[model samples]
Target chain A: MTMKYKDNPQAVADLVRPAEVHRDLYIDDEVFALEMKHLFASTWVYVGHESQVPNAGDYFATDVAAQPILLARHTDGEVYVLHNRCPHKGTKIVIDRTGNTGKFFRCPYHAWSFRTNGKLLAIPLKKGYKDTGFEQSEAGQSGLPPVGAVKNYRGFIFVRMNQEGISFEEFFGGSLSSLDNMVDRSPVGKLEVAGPPLRYMHNCNWKMLVDNQTDTCHPMVAHESSAGTAVEIWESIEKDENTKTPMAMEVIAPFMSPYEFFEDMGIRTWPNGHGHTGVHHSIHSDYSAIPGYLEMMVEAYGEERAKAILGENRHNTVYFPNIMIKGPIQQLRVFIPLAANKTLVESYIFRLVDAPDMLLERTAMYNRLINAPTSIVGHDDLEMYERAQEGLHSQELEWVNVQRLYDADEDLDEEAVENGTTERQMRNQFHAWKKFVVASMEAEARDLTDA
Target chain B: MTLPTRDDLIDFVYHEARVIDEGRFDEWLELWGSDSYYWMPLDYQQDNPKNMTSLMYEDAFLRKLRVERLNGLRTFSQKPKSRCSHVLNRPSIEAFDPKAGQFITRTAVHYVETRLDDQFLLAATVHHHFEMVEDELKIKLKRVDLLNCDAAFGNIQLFI
Candidate 1:
C-alpha cells in the first residue's frame, strides 16, 4: 500500500520470489504500466498470423505493448510488423481491423501514401514543406518503422518491439514444438483463419488470464458448476458401454475430470516464461478420432511421422507475455491489456487445411462450448477472474500462494517439469515477468549510480 | 382445434421469452422442438453457423446442458442470479402457412441482462420459426442477430 516498488525495480522483482508473489503484481497500476512499457515491448508478443495476410498488401491492424501496429505482407512477398502510425501526423494509418491495402496505405487524414511494408511512397503538398527544409529532414524520409524483430514461423507470426531480450528461438525454446505440432497436424502443414475471432472482455489483469492457462488445478473446482453439471447430466442418461458420448457432452464433461487426471497429465515450463500442460494427456486426449483425419495425416507425413504429429496432444501452451495456444485443438487466445483493471481476450480457431473438415468443426464446437461469451463453462471462469480482481483490492492480504509442488519440480536444463497441479508454472511466469520488467529498471539504476 | 390466429403466434413468441426470463429451465426446454438450434451469429452477414465460428450455435442437447449448468448448485457465477427483461417490438408475421403448419415471426428486441449491480443492454432482431409439434407450437429455430454481434462482450450469462 505504501508503493515502495513504484520506482524500485529490484523491490518489484523481489515481489516475485521463489514460492509466493506479492498481491500488488495483480492490483498495482504502476506494475501494470511498467509491464506494458518494458516487458511487452522487449518480449515476443504474437501479432496476427501469416495466414491472415496471405496476399501481398494485406494487413491486420493490432497492438503490441499498447502501441498500434500492423502485420502486413509487402509487395516483395515478405511479412513485416510495422508501427501503424503515420510519420507526418502520428495518427494511426489503418482504421479498419483487417483488409487489403492494395499497393499502398493512404492515410485518412492526409494524402501521405505508404507501401504495404510502411515505407513512405509519396506525400502530397511536397512544395509546402520544401521551403521550410522539412522535405529533406530525416523525419520526412522516416516511414512507418517495423518493430525490432519479426518472425513468420510457419504462418504463425510473432514480433518483439525492442529486441533487448532473448532471441525469438531462445525465448520460445522447446516450446516452439507446440506451434510445430499444431501446424503439422495439417496434411500440408498449414492452417488458415476460420473466421473472425470471439473477443471477450474481462475486468481483471491480463496476467490472471495467462496464469489461468497452466493453473490446471482450478478447472475441476471452478468449472464444476458448468462442466461438472455436464458430467452429471451425461451420467443420468443410460446408454450402452460401447456407445460413444455425444460430441457436445464429450467436450464439456472433461472439465470435471478428477484431480488425479490432471496431476498425471503433468506440466512443463521453459525459460523466458513459456509452458504447457497435458504433455502426455489432457481433456483433449480421448477425443474420438475425427472421421478420415488420420488417413489425411498419414498421406502427408507417412506412418511414423503422422503418428508423431498426431501423438503430440498438448492442451495449453503459454507463450510468455500474452499468448496461449492449444496445439491439439488448433485454438489460440491472446490477452490484450487495456488497463490494470481490464483485459480483453480474443479467441481464434484455426482450420487445419486438407484435414477432415470435422476437425475444425470440433474446434469450433470446443471454442463455443468452452470459451464463448455465451458459454456455460466460460461464465464460471469469468466469474472467478472478475471476483479475483475485486478481491485483490483488500488491504489485509499482501501475497498470493504459488508454492504447490514447487519442491517436487524436476529441474532440467532449460525448463522445470512438474505435475499439472503444481503452481510452478505461475512461478516460472513471474520469474520471467521480473526479468523483463526489472531489467530496464536495473539498467536505469546502474546509469543513475554511475552518474 | 380452430386455426390459430396471428395473435396466437405472437403470444407463443412472448411466452417463450417469458420462460427464459423467469429462469424456467423446464419450460424453456419444453418450448423447443426435438430438432432445433439457438443461434447467435458472430457477424451480421454471417450466413451459416455449421463449421465457421459464431458467438454460439447450440443445438438441442447444448441448450439443455446450458440450462442444467445454470441450475447447478455449484454455479457460483449465478450466486447473484442474473435476470433479464425483454422489450420487443410487435413481431411482424414473416410467414403464415396454416396448411403447411409452419409460422415465422421477426421482432426487434432490446434485451437487458443484469446481475448484481452491473447491467448491459443488447439490441437484437429476434427471429423465430415455429412448427406445430403434437398440437403445440414449438420453436424450430431461434436466431438472435445482436446489434453488436461482432463486438467484444463479457460473458452473456443467459440467452438473448
Candidate 2:
C-alpha cells in the first residue's frame, strides 16, 4: 500500500527530481521547518563525544536537531542524553555550554534538582505540593524527558528522538569504517580530542556545506588564487637555492590538482547518504618519514595489520546529515544548522593515544593552517559557500543542477563507484532526503487523523 | 643590577604595534629573538602545547612563512590588505630577575581592524617576556590571551 501525504505531496516530490533540486529547497522557510520536523527529528543525530564527559557528573551541552540536549555521565559511568529544559516551570538546566555539574543538576530557576542521569532528586519546597496533584513517584515531578534512543559506539554517542527507525549499526553501515580506521590508529583503539574545537559560522544553507565535502569539481576553481600563492612562494624559494616544496605549500597545492588526477581517485557511496573520495595519505604521506612511529605500530599490532591500517588512505568521509570525518588527518568537522541561511562548523582535532608526538603536532598544524579562521586555504571555501547562497537568491535561477553523470551506473549499490568528479553523491543524498521526508509527512498526517 | 624602565617597555610595545599595523613586515621581524615563540592558545588555561592545540602557534620558520605570504603580491586575501589600529593600555613591569636577565610586562590591548568595508574588534591581554641581548630587548615569548579567543571569528590575517 502506498502512503499519501495530507498536504501537497507533489510539491515535496517535485522539490527533488532525479537530476536537479529546486532552489527553494534551500531557502524556503516552509521546507526548512519540514526538514527540522521530518528529517532532523526522526533521524539519528550526533551528540557530544563520550570522552568529553569521562568522569561522573561531567556534562556537555549541545543540540540535536536544533533542540537543546544535554549529554552527561552518571556515577555508574553510563552516559545519558536528555532535553535541556527543566521539568518545573520549563527553564534550562545547564546555563553554560559545558562543565562538571557536581553531584547533581540544580536548576537556577526554581531550585529543583536532578541527578546526572536526569532523575528527579529534590525540590526546594517539598510540602507545598502535598495535595496539589504533584505525585511523589519516580516520574511525578517529571525530572526531564530523555531522547527515545541513545547509543554509544566506541565512545561516539548518537541519539535519535524517535524510537522507531533503522538501528544505529544499520544506519551507519560501511561508513563505520571511517570511525574504526580513526580509532584503530591507536594501539588500544582509543583516540582523544586533542584540544578545544575551532568554531565558526558560515552564511549558507547547511546542505551546501555538506555537499562541498565530496564535491570535487569546485576545489580547483574555488581555491585557484590561494593555490597560486602557495605555488609562487615555493617557486621563489626554489629559485633562490636548492629546496623541496614547503610542507605548507604541499598542503595547499593538492587543492589545485588537475581534474584527471582527482577523477582517477574513486568516488564511492554506501547505503544511506554516506560517501567519500580522494586519497587518505594526501599531503601527509610524507609523515612516514617520522621515526619509531611505524616500529611502534608494528610492535603493537603486527606488521601485516599495521601496514593495512597505515595503508588505508580514504579522504573526506561524510556520515550524512551532519558529520564529515577526515580520518587520515584525524580531524572531524561537524555542521550544525542554525537556520535556512546559516550554519555553524566545528573543527575537532584528535590525538592518537600512545602515538608519537610528531603526529599530534602535524594534526595541530593542519588545523591551524586549514581550519582556523586565519586559514588562507579555508577563506576560499567560505567565500564560495557565501557566494553560492547569495546567488541562489536570484529570481531567475529555479534549479540547482546535480546532473553531472546523473545517468551513470554509480547509483546501484553493487556498482556504487564513479569518478571523483561525478555528482552521484549529491544525487544519492537527495534520494535519502526524499525518502526521509515522505515517511515523515505520512506519519505526521496519520497522527493528525488520529488526534 | 640595572633593568629597563616602564617607559622603555611601553615604547618597545608601541613601536612593535606600530610596525605591525603599518605592514612593515621586515621591521616587525627584527623585533623577535632568534628563538622566539608567538602563541595564541586554544584553551583558557592551557597546560602544554605539545599535547594540546593552539590557534596561532608559530616558530621562527612558520612565522617567516606567514610573513612571506602576507608580504607577497599573490596573497589574494591580502590583496586589499587589512588595516589595523591598536589601542594599548599602560604597561606594568611584573618581574625583573637580575640573574635570569628576563623582564616581564603585561598590557591590555583593544584592536580594531578594517578590510573591504568589514570591520571587527578584538580585545586581548598581551604578555611580553624577554631579555636584553646587549642594549636592546628582544622578545623571547609573546603570548596573547584574546577575551573571546574561543569564540567564532572571521579571518585573522593581519597581526593583532
Comparing only chain B with the true structure, the TM-scores of all models are 0.94, 0.93
Fnat by candidate, in order: 0.80, 0.44
lDDT of each: 0.86, 0.78
Candidate 1 deviation (Cα RMSD): 2.0
Tens-place lDDT per residue, model 1, A1-451, is: 6777656887887888788888888888888878887799888889988889899999999878988998889999999899988888788889789999899989888879988888888888777786787767765877888898888889888988885666888878888999999999999998998999888999999999999999888888998887877777778878897877888877878888898999989898888889999988888988889888898889888999999988888989999989999999899999999889899899999998888888888888889888888887778889999999999889998888888877744342367667788877888898888888898778767878999
Expressed as tens digits, the lDDT of each residue in A263-337 for candidate 2 is 877778877788887543343344444578878888989999998988877778888778888777788888888
Candidate 1's C-alpha runs over 4 A off are A1-7, A135-138, A240-244, A408-413, A444-451, B1-4, B99-101
Residue-level error in angstroms, candidate 2, position A223: 3.1
Residue lDDT tens for model 1, B1-160: 4465799889988887888788887778888887888989987778988577878887777777788877778898899889998888889999899988778999999999999999999999988988777777788998899998878898788888
Q: Which ten-residue region of model 1 chain B has the weakest summed lDDT?
A: B1-10
Looking at candidate 2, what is the lDDT of residue B130?
A: 80
- Quality of model 1 by C-alpha lDDT: 0.86
**How high is the DockQ of candidate 2?**
0.43
The worst-scoring run of ten residues by lDDT in candidate 1 chain A lies at A408-417
User: How many backbone clashes can be found in candidate 1?
Assistant: 0
